[model samples]
Target: MFAPFAPMLRRAALVPSVHRLLPSNSRSLYQNIIKRHEDMATEHGSPSSSGEMHDALDVLSSESSPISTIPLDPDTDYAALAIPSLQSKNKANLPPLMNIPPQEDPLLHHIASRIMNHGERAKASRTVSQMLLHLHAWTRSPPLPILRQAIFKLSPAVKVIGHKHSTKMIYKPVPLSEKQGIWLATEWILDAIKGRQGGPTLAERMAREVILILKNESKTLEKKEAYHKSAMMNRGNIAIART
Candidate 1:
């Protein structure tokens, strides 16, 4: 009986009671918290923990899917799988091109060609351009119209050419066609300008002649009148000059 009582006392001293370490109210509160934890654990374990974990993994995989399975936002995108672009549709609104070239005046081109010395066409073009610019400076209006007026005033209705009137050749005036009249007028202008004195450049000479013709005092006009006189007197030879 003594041995049993000594062993029982030793055991009771080794183990401490919860009531001694904590107040009665604290001990009751602690018990209530532990009971709530145990009930929650049992409820969660009853519904298969592994099954819930697998369901969560499936949800994550669906959110990160390679193929889209949701409708696109109407404002932000046209379609879910389609690329966004309008490169071709916007281009249709632009104006169409005809691919036509720019054209210069025919008389201007012809004059430039006639002025060309050797194969230096670029130089001749510069000279002609300078001449036109000078005309522009003197007159406030466009130069080409004034130039055409001068050409019309100076171009004779007939040209004198030598024709055989028996064994000897006699000079006779013949009626000139429209094209020939233009050519003869331009030639007279060029010839008159070429024979000038005290002009520094060919462009200046040509400009001065053009201006004089506009004022009705150019040498070209005189030559034109002289030709008309001879043509009038030689009208008798018109029949012979036709051949």
Candidate 2:
């Protein structure tokens, strides 16, 4: 009975020692495996078994090729992107002078120059000259038939006021010539520029007078058109006068 009990007790004592050795061996094996993985990761430019493979791949790819690492648009214009500041610099470096032709008419050139330099009198003078020149061109050497017709239209009607019952009308023809018409037009323009005797002065009313004189519906322009229309209607007079 004692011998059997002794074997049982020795086996029970060996079981605790085996359990203690098993834990130490398993821990050393696990540490060795972890160290081996770290060494492999260092050699291959990757991370250990810590789940950092994606981050390691990004770093490795960026370090391999720097140009390809940055994302760029396929249609991007690299040259335009590189020197954006040069465009403004080139514009600033251009010469200030411009190419323009000189005015042919001396009076027109003078007026334009003065207007550009903000001369007050130049504008008034220009307006007067322009109106006069236009009127002169239209009225100069008008057909004799047209002149007679215009005069007839302009003739004043004299009404004879009789005492009892009879009433009569007399037409007085106003003599008009192309020279006279041109002279009157010039004088009219001058008066407008100078303003009325009791009205505004040239400095105060020059612009207003200029606008009125140069208008298409002006009295002077209406007179010119009336003359032209009257001439057209009396074309037969032109043939008669030539005879």
TM-score per candidate: 0.53, 0.23
Q: What is the C-alpha RMSD of each candidate to the true structure, in Å?
A: 29.2, 32.7
- Candidate 1 Cα lDDT to native: 0.74
Output candidate 1 Cα RMSD: 29.2
Worst 10 residues of 1 by lDDT: 59-68
Off by over 4 Å in 2: 1-185, 191-195, 203-206, 240-243
Error of model 2, residue 222, in angstroms: 2.2
**Full-model lDDT for every candidate:** 0.74, 0.47
Prediction 1 TM-score vs. true: 0.53
Model 1 agreement with the true structure over 22-109: per-residue lDDT tens digits: 5667656665665565567668875455455445434433424243489756787555334334545557676787867549676677
Clashes of 2: 0
TM-score of 2: 0.23
Q: What is the lDDT of residue 196 in candidate 2?
A: 61
Q: How well does candidate 2 match the true structure, expressed as C-alpha RMSD?
A: 32.7
